[model samples]
Target chain A: MRKKANPFFYLFLVVFVFFVMFPFLWMLLSSIKPLSELFGDKAFTPFSSHPTFQSYVSVFVDYPFMRYLWNSAVVSTITTVYTVIVASFAAYAIARLQFKGKTFILGIVLSVSMFPQIATISPIYIFLKNIGLTNSYLGLIIPYTTFALPLSIWLLVTFYRKIPGDLEEAAKMDGATLMQTYWKVIMPLAVPGMFTTAILVFIAAWNEFLFALTINTDTNYKTVPVGIAMFQGQFTIPWGEISAATVVVTVPLVIMVLIFQRRIVSGLTSGSVKE
Target chain B: MKNSGMEGQAGVELNKQDARLPVKKAPKRERQKKESRAALYLVAPAMILIFIVAVWPVLQSFYYSLFDLRLSDPKKSEVHLKYSVDLGRYLDNYPFLISSIDSEIKKGNDAAELQDIKEKLQSLDEKLQKDPKVKSQYNAVNDKLMNFKQPSEDIRFADVEKSTAEEFSKTTESVSSQLNKAAKKTEFTQEKKLLGLASGMKDSIIKPTFIGLKHYKEDLTEPRMWRALGNTLTFTVISVAAELVLGLAIALLINKAFFGRGLIRASILIPWAIPTAVSAMMWSFLYDGQNGIVAKLFESVGIVDKMSNLLTTSTGAMFSVIFTDVWKTTPYMSLLLLAGLQTIPSSLYEAASIDGAGKWKQFTNVTLPLLKSSILVALLFRTLDAFRVFDLIYVLTGGGPANSTETISILAYKVMFSQTNFGEGSALSVIVFLCVAVISMLFIKFLGRDLLNDGNGAGR
Candidate 1:
């Protein structure tokens, strides 16, 4: 039988949980409360509001939120698709191909991962303006690919290298070109890395704010983060509308993670801090 | 498995190309050459894209810094000019001609030529106010005029860099006086200042040039640059310290098996997974002071009976940001340390227990040293990240309650973007890059080989 828990651990656990969970719970609470109850001196509770979907209703009816959601989905999905595809083929090349400058390419890709996105933001902004990519989905897609590629390529390379070359050599000896060898032999083994790269890229694409904020000026194509951030208009802070929008935006990721926690954790750990 | 030889590791030791020697076994020379070409072709997509997307923009940013182009423009006069400069660069470009002049003033060799250029420039400025093209050119010229002059040793040559920084705040200070005030500051009247001004002026006669030691020289002189460095140092120390202590506490608590352990674990990851900007925005809303939970908690805890907000005052605002950052990021630190904790192989604990070691003894002797690499990893990442934190502060406070929370990154953004001072921004970016590189180098050198090899012995 489990004995009484360490009091020290228990006390610390309570404080930790309170600190972590308080904001989320408060978000839920504040979302329901009507404007009047939210403003009052008394402490607010999740159920304090008049139990209304009025905030949710207003968010959809009032703003082009659905359009924003669509735009975000379109851009992030395109980014994920390109990152995975490009990173996979390229990763396959680096890991398997004994091509010239192979190590040089790997080191350059690795260094690119560490370069601060902020330093390059101004230059990219100017370049995009020249190419007429600014204020467009293509603008976001191109840069997002750039941002996501290094991580995608790194993760894929790690996993690809983990696979044995014997599998590909067998295919190669059996009358396969290197392209066919990669597609037929090694690609199937790299499923885990591919999925991991796709999901992480999706997350990065969804989470990107700086580019979405500055590059895109119009509301028609705003991402969820930018949309909710600039939600405040001419007069009052639309707390209700903004909160509802956040809940809607956050729900998909929360659900996706809850359903696929194993994959995401493996993806995140390997794709970032570890091999 | 002999990766040391087969795996691709380039020799950085050789600055030039490595001399390739022939290997004994080759399947077919003709086929091998074709395959090599194919391999280059295969990797070409990623290589080209990486170049276009990643390195190209930086090259573009550097090149743009050389010319003068302000985005707040509508255009034409060869599209841009090099006449505009900034204080730091002017200070950098000392013995440089013509610091701060009227928008109408243009660069010339002597005072008489300078006056003629000034008249022509003034006429251009008035026209610019009306014409979009002229206005764009005018703003470009104006920025150059206000920022060009540097302090020189000779009496006639010294053009005080007047403060145009507060000009957007001040309506009365014309571009010319701004230059004078900056030039007149005899505070930098030292030998190093004279040399820096002289060297910087000569480096670029037309555009701003680097005085090799000007940035360093200004580090001793300029208050704003020094303030930014101080801010970066302060932010790094406080944030990392708080994160470490708090993260360790949480990791220890969660290490013990408990009810709702899985739920709590997942719940903790929630904060980490939520994007930094989103979390910052969420805290900003909750920290809305007038109706914030922070105010409510303060009242509830008996700290302040009057339910006051924490963001209205400068210190309070700073605390509010720190508190939110700690709450959100401590999980990342814990996760890493927890990973390290897992690697400890509880057999050590079992052995300690058998030896009759106490819990404190086991933790101190058994766990602490074992946990070193991961702790360093966590510390390195957090410290570097904290030093350059931009998004969180940008979202929450915009570096305010009077610039109290402005870190180096935010200060760089303002100088580079908001003020359109490319030279200063470029200098700032280079400094930030160096600082990050230095930290990484220190971590690698001191933390042993963990920087390159992840603790898990996979690659080897």
Candidate 2:
């Protein structure tokens, strides 16, 4: 298409791509290898050799990896659903509602979202534990809802703000109560924003390792990250086992991203809300 | 285009074109209190959970830091049986020996039948009481006996010497016997274990409690803790700085439309999107000194003449852990910065070019200042994350080779889960929160406002 290209530029790009993908590719490749081969004579190219399905089998057979996946799925789905429902109204208030301390409330929620998980996990763990929610689905669900609400509220607020007030005023004049108007009116229109918020909440909940790991000790209640971290710890960390499990686990997330490619807004994901 | 679209939907003023939208329609001020009450009620579930898990934890940890609490015992603050078998003790022992045995009355060397061999092995170990050579090798033998199998033939595992190796032979024999007994016992319990696993876990683990700040004070005052803290900060600062710069560069470079751009974008995200725990595990293996990829790279590049284990030495271990962390998180840093880059209006660039601004000047005067929010967000998130870093270090190095990579988070974990030192762990948790707050406040002072403001402009 052009004059001779800069070989160095192409080379740099190739190297960069390779560097970025090498670990994940290695992960996928290594997952199929037997433990012996994974830990074989340590060569960078150990991945290129004969691979096996032993690790995958072992992860399924030896551990409750499937339970972990189910836990993650259930938690993420509930969190996402609840988050959208809760946050849409909350954000609408912040964005369009006239109320005292609106800015303060919005700021508070935003600050909550920014609050480090580590800073909050200890106290949360104790409180949840006291309620017999520790190591329970209810415990995990409640926390997930709490942590996700802020971001959901923030993003949905932006989306709600973008919707013309006339749309809501018409419904309000129709004598729809606020809840009905929010559910039947603002919601039907904010599908795109809702989807964006849902995906983000799901991702956050799915990948959350800190609170999940600390609070839940039982494998059945544990989410994927904790499941995997603890799952194969008994054995010498089999890259094959971890890799295969990771693939099984991450494939769903990857598929989700791919299917919802439209939602993949690299900027804070959909840039659906301002802080 | 507008007329064509409006023609079908038009009965109700399709010509109305105001972008001003009411996010909410509040009633008169007289009814405001009623709405506020309703609003609080609606948000109660989420707020209550937040208070319980997030807010309560911070406060409880602070409160617990004030008094001694223990999990291993309801009376835990009492320092009885607090010490546990740990890496240091394990290393210092070089091998654990149960006891010494008198070497007498052994049949011919048929490697001893698995049962008799274990008995003989157990006795031989017991007789090593005063013998340094036998005792030193005792622990290693005992481990193999307990494990009942050979360590994998990874480059990561070095060969025990022949002299030490022989001791292992006897240990293996003992393990075979133990395995038989375990198999027999499990055969009966198989059905029960399958169903009772949940109950078992619940029974075994005691509930966690709030312990006071004794441990945090100890960590602060202790030289070892301070040294570890210093190392962690140094590692976090250097690696995070490198990652921020590198991520920005990479994101900017890849942001442009190019051949295979989609593929490259996904590729870059692959490393980031993979769980950090998985990456840490992979890198730890790669950092294996012998036959390791990292070692090979270093050797060939002449950085070091010999195959040096990055995990075995203090400085090397620190460097290895930090390098691995940077490699894994740089993509995330880049992605955040990239989002920031996209938010910047392209008109500014056009205007700059019209003003005769050079590329470097445009980047410095226009691009950088504009990207400030994104940079601040990226820096704040990454720095806070690095301080609490545990999964990576736990999987990669286990805060190893003399605890060089140990951060407050890891210490909190060990104190709570491992030692069952709830008081100490709670104290440490409060400290960790303080550390995070201080760092975050500093970030806010420096660039936090821009990042917060950027959030508004971020969501389109």
Candidate 3:
């Protein structure tokens, strides 16, 4: 550790933390204020004189927010689960086995990560409509899983490589088949890495707006992001309910980040940095 | 102790000994083949999914771009390879029109000219029925129409010869004009319905909408496309550059040994963890003209002339979005850079200090050179991400203030979905894809070579 911190460093930290935390703080505070207080001079006040949970009630009662939350949960959960399973198999293959076109496969994964989603939206929409999959959970899950595979595979490959080859050799010597060795031995060791990938994948699927907006336009299947985006009222903007919904959606994610901060950071930078 | 050089020679000798073992080579090769087969099986599911969802759709979009497909226009809704007729529509009008003309002729109004028009229409209908395929479909559609039931799609459209389609269109047009002239001279009750049915018959002759590459030509030359591309580039360059600087500063700050470092790190990630749409909404609220706190802060700090001006003006809206982006993404950038920073050995800084180097010199000499790859990787990711921005601009300003903030993706979406011009929108989408491809190629060629090579090596 350094001997002594400078005053300027402390000042920078204070300013940086404030800049980062202000929006979240504002969102939470604004969600609790009454509609009357939110519109006029009282909006500037950091603390509302009389806080109310009316907006929270309105989010669930007046609007179909419960359905949106359920829709988002289902889509994100399935996307995360499906992406992790498929990506783990591919990642294990690339990491443990010598194969032709491994580099080409990795290149494909990298390119898919950078693909623009708008370019593919129309055809996908047409396809979903033709197959009657639009306005269904599978519609969002399919695309979300496809988009999440690249990063999940990349992260898992790094994790799989860290496991010793000797263990697999030992398992093989014990008369275990290749699939048995993978399922019984390697997968157990990859749980931490999968957890990290799951967090990232779930967050991504939860936050995906474009595909959700286009693919599932039915109100019954609108996810949280789409629901909040398309939120409206007869005459007003419904900022209060929107803010309440945002807080509801974001708090769980913030908690997840806090709990898995180290894993998340390591998973994100695994392939990018070399020592 | 044994010499290290001798250990290397012994290792090579052991490999040679292994090679001499009997029947070792064949089984080893077989095992290797089996492993390769297993690897293929493992990777096939993921590759197939990606192909179906991502690759296939892009190719389909390219194909759709070759035609003029508009949802609002009934005839142009799908790809038409050749001239065809909506038989249901034709039967709906053709029989009614023929009967109306017959009644007019019986009324003794220009009998000779009306007789010529009626015979022409009969010959055109006969010519259309000469093709067996059209004849069958016409009968099927005519039956359905007579029963007052809607004709199914398979039986409703029939392919016709180009000559037949042209004659059908011409006869209906001429007959409708002649009826119009007769209606002016004589009192006729069915004249208005007859003219409408005649014109409707003309529309039943569907033309081929496949204008190959025409949309591409128009969009590539259009000023609106150029402006959207310009806006995209401007947003990408400015926001990425700002994030690089601010992220570097934050990365350096958080990398130091300090109190509450973990807490600070987690707190900063809050912005990134929030969904982009939600964040856009949050910023819009903050930038609201009437009651927004950030807008007021900007005005009081002299960043804007007024609180409302921040989101209402072109320059101010651009500045506001860029500022919000830098706020949201800088933490992610810093996190990546910090990973790179942690890999640098502390001994290098110590050696620099021993050589009488100051902080600035150490950053320039030791840190920047080693951190080049990380910086490039971060920039490549951020640049592409910023270029393809949609939800943020879509939700915040909605590409408004006279579309000064419309990016290529937003414009493509509007063209495709809002206006239902799928062909033109598809052309725009292909353009966006081309731009992304070019950007990726440029980055890979100039800066990301080592990063990609490292990716390949990492798997090995």
DockQ for candidate 1, please give it: 0.35
For model 1, residues B286-335, the per-residue Cα lDDT tens digits are 87766777666776786554555466666677777788888888887777
Candidate 1: residue B143 lDDT (0-100): 54
Ranking by lDDT: 3, 1, 2
**How many backbone clashes does every candidate have?**
14, 32, 0
Per DockQ, the best of the predicted structures is 3
Chain A alone, TM-score for each of the models?
0.89, 0.86, 0.95
Runs off by more than 4 Å, candidate 2: A1-11, A34-36, A39-49, A122-134, A173-176, A231-235, A266-275, B1-41, B76-217, B290-292, B302-308, B448-460
What DockQ number belongs to candidate 3?
Answer: 0.57
Regions more than 4 Å wrong, model 3: A1-7, B1-26, B458-460
lDDT of 2 by residue, B1-460 (tens): 1222332343144223221333243434544576666676665665565566566666766666665666656434332222211212222222222111111112222322334534654453354333454344445544654676442223112223344334544454444444345445443223233223212211211222333345666778888667667876987798899998899898777555456655655555555655677567667656667535666676688765665656777777777778888887887677777776776777888889899999899899987998776687678778877887878887777778788778767767777768766666776666666777788888778864543443333222
- Cα miss at B157, model 1 (Å)? 31
Q: What is the TM-score of chain B in candidate 2?
A: 0.62
TM-score of chain B in each prediction: 0.60, 0.62, 0.93
TM-score of each predicted structure versus truth: 0.73, 0.71, 0.95
Judged by DockQ cut-offs, is candidate 2 incorrect, acceptable, medium or high? Answer: incorrect
Please write out the lDDT profile of model 3 over residues B1-460, one tens digit for every residue. 1223443454465456557874443456787899999999999998888888888888988999999998778889888989989998899988988898788889876677778878988998999999999899999898888899999998999988888888888888887887788778877667778779878888999999999999999998999999999999999999999999989987877777877777877876788888899999988999999999999899999999999999989999999888989999998999999999988888899999999999999999999998988888888889989999999999899988898999999999999889999999999999999989999888888674675556345323
